[model samples]
Target: MSEFKQLYKPLLDGANWQQPDQLGIEGTEIGHWLLEQDSLSRRFQRHCEAFTVSLIEQVKISHAALTNDERALIGDEDCLLRKVVLQGDGQPWVFARTLIPISTLTGQERDLEQLGEMPLGFRVFTDRSGRRDALVVADVGTDTQPLWARRSRLWINEKPLLVAELFLAQAPIYGKEKQC
Candidate 1:
């Protein structure tokens, strides 16, 4: 177990990223990172003027069973899955996977049909009517030691879309690890 997992897994994995003000959770290193309000693109740009979003994989995949909160908003349906790494000065900082349900695609939201290398935050943050839902934060992987991750639900034109963004363990804040 990582020093952090021993220190915060009970606090992080079980956390409802929405209520960040909860006791015993404040003043955490990872907590501050996840609490940033700036668009991810802008944040990366600040880190390096030559920041880039490298497309890792994007595909339309069969939807898997979702959690209760997710199913309540966007019904279970095949979704467009986009995975990308946000790089700062050629170094990867974040691994982001955005899942846009086919059922939620309607009207202008359909513009996501071809995202290419654009940051999903660009599409969601720019919408005047769009609103970000409470983030669901966790660090869930095979190791289960805990890493930083945040899930956001953006409502554009009343259409709900789910996006999950993970802060790579090597992302400099928690202490950089080998890039590979």
Candidate 2:
């Protein structure tokens, strides 16, 4: 259990996820910010004239096993866990992480492993299986104020990949000035 905990430490899986339309968010502007339509990567591009995807970490951990939810979507496969920050006009905005199985990277998505600093959604939206669905949205933070986040599965040829996007605490949508 401790090993599982440590492996998923970088993720914010502490709270339960809610559906946007079903969730009764009255006074929370943050909730609305996270419920934006279309792919987040595309939204960032449209909103910000100069958007960037900055890779933070990409590693292979043999000791780490997938969570039950992840395993269901990704299957019993070795994955490349990659994390990145979405910056808008040089301002830190959203933090995104993806768990991509090695098998998925070798097929139609052969180019995915080489995305480097490019947005993950670029490859995600290319093929017919790029549509994102079965989303889980939540708000997480150790402090009193929590940031909004969403997760979903991206499928290609029936193979699944998990993608999570978190609206950072310092993100402009919360309180700061315009990002673009």
Candidate 3:
């Protein structure tokens, strides 16, 4: 198991599995502010909040082993495991891991369009038997247009780990003529 896994295991086993809303640092402004607070409970709450934001913004998933359907599903929403590593004075701290679900797109075309604009890396593969699969990596400026046009599924990864998947389904192409 990786260091993060080891650090996070205890939190996962605990009962208070709430998502964080922020990330607390040791000496920065947010950190100082949180430290000055009188209560340890409030301090911990602030720390979790800061950690949450960092997880969403910095944590990345590499998608090298996912089906096309999985890729499509991730493209439609932000569902994935959010993680963060914090360096302390004596040791490194791994925050709890939370599986966040992405919102699904309602219409086929609309969702496809949305996927096309994602700034994450995407890849498509086909097996000899004609099975299709795709992988997605969460990074800055990764494109999703090719996936949409080809109707490929999506997966995301980080540190050689699969974090999320997207699935696509067929839907009727609606036109202006159907309106009464």
Candidate 4:
């Protein structure tokens, strides 16, 4: 197996990219470089920015659900959910939502220090037809992990009965002997 394939096999096999507590030296370096120059990074950022704006607009429209007093109390509810969208070139776009509580607003702000950062992981999915699809990095968080409890309904129309979810956790290390 090639180096790239070896590095990403676990993630591809798992079908869920999970962030690890700590990345290896080489992994960290690669992550940094990719975030700066990869085509995937560029596409991901574009889509994520657009998705976030759209989500915010949606939230604003739904603000009517809250009473006037409640709206005034919350002031800007945008702080509650931070949306990130990613779309790799020639790849399907991915939307990720990070939920932040009002209590830790300051911490959340600090976490955005590396708002557009990418982690040391990549994912590839194969459809029933045997075609491979690349999964883009949609978001990263520090104040709190994103809630993946609710399956996103966005995939319903595209793939009937399909439910998409986000999972934030540690990724398994690829042992040297098991490379690829």
Candidate 5:
């Protein structure tokens, strides 16, 4: 178990996730990021002068530790939990967490386990057969400083992986204007 997982999983579990429309973010930029079907990494690349993916940790998570929604999608199987920070122009913009069921890492999909420092969108989006479902949005962090987030299940060739992205306070989107 990683210290990062220990610290953040609770916050993720505590989130009250709902659809973007349910939260009244429909016409906003934050809503755009949460609801858009495009590759978020590609969007950031277009908006920022420089972009990078920083891996924080990748570790196996026991089936017992998964949230109910996670278990429903991944079938209570042990999975790899990958955490990374997406940076734009040297500033931390998004914190991303992914849960990959061990069973899904077979055949060509095994490459997912070795994507060190590569944006996940680079791999997941390249496959034409991939699709997403259960997109939900939430506000995490403390009451005084809330962070926007979105969670969804990405299906590639019928295999499932859960992905969640939290927009950090320093993210370019939270600036005076939507910078990125």
Candidate 6:
């Protein structure tokens, strides 16, 4: 396992994922956020005066060490794992984790490894070659304080990157409801 995985085992281990529609959240506001096809960072900025991406850690993990779900999506290749928290008005709103295969970092794409304090969603949206796959939702927090998350495969220059973003309790995407 990567250091990030070891450090965040509770969040990443044994996660349960389901289609948003199957979970009956497709018509809700949080559902809208979960199913957004555009840049989540842009949508977040529209709801908050200030938005920031705070890096937690970035590490490289061997394919043999990745979680089963991660391995299934990213295939059997060594990858770079990046963890960050997206904040709105100084309050943490989302925890994002990205997996980029080492082979994907070629030419201009190597810039992805050096995006300190920059949101991955912004980069994906700005890049014309970026394409988003279908999303899956999960409850990663707890019963009392559910942290809803969305995960998807992003293709940039025909390379695959996995992105998972868990909505924090203070996220405005939760709106007036406590659960999606």
Per-model TM-score, in order, reads 0.73, 0.79, 0.23, 0.24, 0.89, 0.89
Model 1 lDDT per residue over 37-150, tens place: 547676556556577787767778776745566666566887887777777777767777677888667789988767777887788778887777766566543365456677
Looking at model 4, residue 133 earns an lDDT score of 22
lDDT of 4 by residue, 16-83 (tens): 33232223322553343222222232333443323111221112124344334234433334334334
lDDT of 6 by residue, 1-180 (tens): 244345444575546888877889888877888898888888888877788988988999888877778878878899998988889889888777889999888877899999989998888889999888867998887788777888899988888899988787888876763321
On lDDT, the leading prediction is: 5
Rank the candidate models, highest lDDT first. Answer: 5, 6, 2, 1, 4, 3
Ranking of all predicted structures according to TM-score, beginning with the best and ending with the worst: 5, 6, 2, 1, 4, 3
Q: On a 0 to 100 scale, what is the lDDT of residue 26 in model 6?
A: 82
Model 6: how far residue 153 lies from native, Å: 0.7
- Model 4 poorest ten-residue lDDT run: 153-162
lDDT of each: 0.66, 0.71, 0.26, 0.27, 0.83, 0.82
As for candidate 6, its clashing pairs are none
The 10 consecutive residues of candidate 3 with the worst lDDT sum are: 166-175
TM-score result, candidate 5 = 0.89
Task: State the lDDT of candidate 3 residue by residue for 156-180, as single tens digits.
Answer: 2211112221111110111111211
For each of the candidates, give the backbone clash count: 0, 0, 33, 1, 0, 0
Residue pairs in collision within model 2:
none
Candidate 2 residue lDDT tens string, 1-180:
233224333555654677766665634665555665346777667667888987878876441577787787677778988878888878767777789888877756777778889887777776666676777787666568767778888776676778888777666657743545
State residue 116's C-alpha deviation in candidate 5, in Å: 0.8
- What TM-score does structure 3 among the candidates reach? 0.23
Could you tell which candidate, 2 or 3, scores higher by lDDT?
A: 2
